[model samples]
Target: MELLNLPGNIIETVVRMLVNQRKTEEIKIRRLNFVQCLEDVLNLRATCVRLLEIVNNTRLKFPCVVNFSWKDPELNFDLHCFINFMANDTNWRFETVRFRKTLFHVEETNSGLLSIMQKNASLFAKSVARLNFDLPLGSNSIVLNVLNLLDWLRRESLKAGGQISFCIKDPFFSNWEAVLLVDHLSIRGSLRRQFDIFIHLVGSQKFPNLSQLDLPDIIFPVAKLCLFRNLHALSICNLELPENEHIPLHSTQITALLLSYAELESDEVECFSNVLCQCFPRLVYLSFKNTYRTTFSDDDNLCLPETCTTVETYSHMLFYFKKCQSIRYFNLQDYYPALDRKIFVKQLLTTLGTRTALMSVRFCGKELTRTDFMSAVENIVEECHSLDVLSVDCCLLDTQDSLNDQTEIDLSKIVRGEKILPIDGQESEAMLKLKDLCRDKQLKLLIMGKTVLYKSTADVRLMGEINKLEDLYKWNLKRGCVQWLSLEN
Candidate 1:
């Protein structure tokens, strides 16, 4: 009460504390399926508060996100003086400035988007270190406007020593581009023109610090991957790599690479792996998501979907992973095994068993059953003594069952020398089984689904924390393994 009654200046400090506390509480509540908007992650402070504090007090300078608006209000001070102050305020920089237009299905044009960017690009150039351009899926493609905006952004944002992350999302879909937007490709050259602009933005020397690119399904059939100078991380989704690949020389500074929903063949796995190694020589983290397609065939007058992973292709995948020695963290999602359980077990161990340098491996899939997955991992633990961290995420694939089944093994007795863990009312039977089996092994268990204890022993602990999503998936910095950052961004 006293703090609220104090002067507004004193109240601002309290507001920051309140914001931090709220974040902690939010994380605690949403333990699993932590849904969030990663892009334009507006800093805790509001734009007005941030700019006011920084302009008045330089120590408070922090990155601020501002949405572009044509009819912008004038501040109390002179615009020229404010910009000049920012020029001298070298330490102060913004995280990103977002430029968004209309939503999907709305009859809006890029004119407003361009209008705001044209007017405000230079005003906050010094403080804007990054740009998050969120655009809607419009029927008409404004290639020239977008190109001009990118060109202007290249000139302005480069001065601020920053880059841009572009995202094109629609109202209806989570990420189904071909199903909806592909029809807008009637004008053949428009798509190519957009690609040209994007490629130019990546390869251009004008924006030397241009880094962190996200070209999701909106820009598929990309002709080539350009060399991103000074780029530390890159993300791409829904791209169909050309059969005839053209990989750039490993002249990049990128450390993290993510490819989602990329259609790749087993025969091409070796070539693609080499291409990745060549393009990002210093890469330490790599992730591939939803790459396995559930192919459906007409079987007995029914279109049945295939459940297993492509054997020859995945076998090649294992072979290719060997070349990526630099990858410390690797994530494979929706890669259901196509081979028989026996052969799949052999392949899993042969590919992942000997890798001594890999610090983390996260497997999230929908198609693999609990039994096959557990057995394969058990072999992995048997073969590899050095590997420590293994995580599984099966949110998309399976149905939950009750824990009342009496045949359920009591793993805690064997692994931890403790009694069986008591199941909460809502606890999934699958996860409980995994914890029961995997607790005793030397390897640290961080699983998202039910799988084998993987070692000779089992584990079980009746702890409330273990059942929560936050506990199973610890978001620690040193042991951080986030594969869905690009999806949210």
Candidate 2:
């Protein structure tokens, strides 16, 4: 019998199975074949009115957590229909619900649409364990509607111990008290006035559960530090540190910190380092990333001179490594002048040598020559006893040879000892020595070269880590650096 002649219940079951089957084999050929077959079946839906009605009317149920991003232009089905399907039940669960500006098209607030959205929000509040909701940025009318809907969602989610992450671009919310419900806040203001206004409005208010903050291109909130007693992660990019004011100390709860494109006077670097050691004594992850003046435009006066990031910066930054003694992962990507790469790396290795908890260390710099990197690895092998992983950017080698003809080298073949990469004399010498050191020390060495190279205990571990990184960071083997702490042995 033709599929169109099937009974209504059978057709409904097929439609629901097609929409809700979340598990699939990861093999490329199998994934492609499954996608093609699914596409053909979906296309057949357009030819049959019954199938379309069943798809729109089916009460879909997802067994696993759902991640719905409403702005995807490639979405094959109508999002409004899916939202209605989700709202059909009051117990639909979700992992993340990201609503971007393109998700909505109405110029003015429609009470009917807003009411439907709020119903979905109520369902999300009860079922979603964690909420990383990014508000839609658009016209004032729609923005207000989304904010009000999210406010209701936040209040209900908070009752169930759910966390909310807000990336605020505009500070003109009707209710400032709504911030008290936020658990993670990211302030994205391009202008200084906007940043100041946001701080002025919310800085003094206490957040009982706010634990993660991202303040980019803004000044440090000196007074508000005490308000967030549970802050665990902070990312400050392109921020100017206060010159003479004494930065207060935070509790030993902060574990992850990122300081990128930071501006500070030559004299303040040391004091800031001392303050960080005292503030976050249990720091487990630290990242220091800076680009020298060469990358800055001529009109960019904010670029600190090469002298600002001298040996003093390294000494001061390394002070935290020595004092904390709890760092597990460290990443440094910077261009330095007036400081020898060898000396800088030697000091870093020496400081981390005694850190028994250190698991991964990554270094990225164009100025670091092959010889300098080899020497750094030798020092790490001699010093760091508990270190399990070492990652380095191959751009530091200054080699003109390409390891693979194609853009993607088969990492599975490399891990299986079935592939060999040809290298230049100087590069090969350093890499061979580096590999020998890692092998002897029983460590995993990851080279972010033409492609990534690493030894995995099994093919599953490498594939799993790759998939996880790709899903979270949109990372691939050809990308910049891998977060080794996310790797499983």
lDDT of 1: 0.39
Query: What are the per-residue Cα lDDT tens digits for candidate 2 across 1-489?
Result: 397788878876876555432212112121112233235345756776777666545544332212233333354245555556456632334434443332433432244434544556654555544444444443565555556656665665434666676666655444555456677887665535665555554455556677888876655644455445578877776434445566555444666666665554455556556555565555544555543322222222222211121111222244333434444444433334344434345555666556532232233343434455456556766566665444333333232222122132332333333323442236545555656666655455454432344556425654454444333322223233222321233
Give a tens-digit lDDT track for model 1, residues 1-489: 343356665655554433332333244232211112211123423345543453344322223333333224442123234334545643333334555542322112255545544554544455455555555553434333445555666666544445455555432222222122110111122334366564554354434534555544444443354555656655666444456666333446656555655455555555554455455556544545442544322221111012111111222234334433333233333244443224335544554456532222333333434455455555555555445545443323233222122232322222233323333222244435545544544555443222323432223431122223222233221222222111011
Could you tell me how far off, in angstroms, the CA of residue 284 lies in candidate 1 after the best superposition? 2.6
TM for candidate 1 is 0.44
Models 1 onward score TM values of: 0.44, 0.56
| lDDT for position 132 in model 1 | 54
Candidate 2 lands at a TM-score of: 0.56
Model 2 worst lDDT run, 10 consecutive residues: 303-312
